[model samples]
Target: MKRTFLLFTMLTTPSVSLADNAVNVVSWGGAYSQAQDDAFNTAFEAQTGISVNMVDADDPAVPLQAQILAGNVTTDVASLGYSDATRLCDENMLMLIDPATLRPAPDGTAAVDDFLPGGLSDCFVATDVYSTIIAYDESKFPENPPDSLADFFDTEGYPGRRGVLKEPRFTLEMALMADGVPAAQVYEILSTPEGLDRAFAKLDTIKDDAIFWEAGAQPPQLLVDGEVVMTQAYNGRIFNAAVDDGKPLKVIWDGQIYEMDGWVIPKDAPNPDDALAYVTFSTDAQALADFAMQISYGPPRKSAASLVGNYKDTDIPMTPNLPTTAQNMANALAFDNDFWVDNLAQLNERFAAWLAS
Candidate 1:
């Protein structure tokens, strides 16, 4: 069950007309970008005679917003974080996705059921899954690695500097988990004001020993330079750092926060139909698996897991980051994007205040 998309770029011709036959996509820049460029962008063009103009972006939200507000919707499809997608949805800045047009299952059912609940909505569909976990320098902690988030904050026992993401969502959840809340109860505990305060109080205990990482690429560098023995990081970036530098690093999947990025169609997009086709094609099981294998991000498509090869006799599928097994994924928490979307500004302000204090 491979999902295929036609990708064509007008490389040779500078003045190609895209009015009727092309789709414009905007996406984050990284290995993910390369994989999409290789798999979908190339294939889509070869098959459909439709050229794709992919706009590489470090932050696509502002540009997308500007384009939409200006009534000059150049981007037909976009890959955005859940929060960004929600913001666009709330602003009525995106078009509703029609799941009926998606590739059908072997049983003749719509493939929409293959996606995780809350991972997609009327206006967006999840494209990839990434985890934020405790990544440690394996060389430094060769004998005994930190097994869980609890050990990450156990300074007296581990006895080293640690790093945590500067964002409040995962950081607060990690703090709550460290304070002994079970993985299943994390979100329930943080939904109330008292619970939020409790998590912050627990975080305050580790504040002095924790180095706050503000950027996605910073934690890996901090780990490589020995600035911190353990830090919270995206599984992909840490894995890339380790493979690139030949450094020994291990990710503790226990209590990891699994977050997803989604494909969203901007409101008033020039080619909404083609954008829908592109999204459906990109999420096909085979294409999803191919992209995941090239990058560390996991695909939400149910069949994508089977496409991954086995590293050993273990049932776990081999990926660039740690294997995403049923057990590992079972304990993983899905970050609440709705909560984050509603509270990001205030929570970020509070986080900054807490950091300064």
Candidate 2:
């Protein structure tokens, strides 16, 4: 376990006066919105003497794209999907913050090592880990539940209308898994032309059973309304919805497609140094844990998982209780940013054709 020494000077430099200059941050609004606003922003102001001007965006990509195209970067830091981060990096719109400068080490190894493998990019660093899984109404399937991706596609066995996202990433992966590829082999199969076609063909089998979801919040509602018996959903969103509505919903973690979201600084941000400090502060163990506990997103930092006690006793074993410990987070699949960046336009075209066909 590696730990970086906190840079005391960065907190005390006279020139870098911690005035109430509001650092801007943009994120998806919902439970995550309120959690970040109440927990992270409040603690940040107390510790750094810098206030935050928080902006909540329902569709983060549109506003972020608009800001970048208009040459006006309003947000100092933005929480974006891995695909979105890759797009921003390609567009030359992100600023890089040296990990060492963010938190100095006495021996001077980059603080990047403390992060999970594939969590850090040149311009972005992962902040949270989430999963897209099959969530079902437990009351309906009281005798037995679909436990894996294969079971999800077994319309005769499960016998209910299913909900799948309108996007390709998880849908393609789930299709491959149902077609009998192991979880680890999902992307490898999809990487090849034959495998990609096979996955799509398998998906076509259940196309009639699926009600495609367009928004993050919609899947849970569909589940609650009995529009679909089981649906693919973000684990945090589903968990929060279940808790709120007292719905007898349970997430099937087997064959779940996990994703990471991160904080990115714009290339020409006005307060680069302050931005680095803010990023570091946000990733600190306690703040990270509080953020995760308040909302259900898992923490990307190893230390952050230890700080949150509630996770240890959750319905699903908290990260620390698993076979792959938080420290060895390298095992998780790195979402293939390059593939998505290169193929999204073409893939979207093909997907539209498939959906209509």
RMSD, each candidate, Å?
4.9, 7.5
TM-score of each: 0.87, 0.82
Stretches of candidate 2 off by over 4 Å are 1-20, 60-72, 103-110, 311-334
Give me the displacement of residue 149 in model 2, in angstroms: 1.4
Residue 54 CA error for candidate 1 (Å)? 1.2
> How well is each residue in 192-248 modelled by candidate 1, as lDDT tens digits?
888889888988877888888888889999988889989988888887786655678
For 238-286, candidate 2 gives per-residue lDDT tens digits of 7777765677888776676667787888765556666777888887656
What's the distance in Å from true for residue 345, model 2?
3.4
lDDT of each: 0.75, 0.70
Which pairs of residues have clashing backbones in candidate 1?
5-44, 6-43, 6-44, 6-45, 7-41, 7-43, 7-44, 7-45, 8-45
Cα error, residue 306 of model 1, in Å, equals 0.5
Give the Cα-based TM-score of candidate 2 against the true structure.
Answer: 0.82
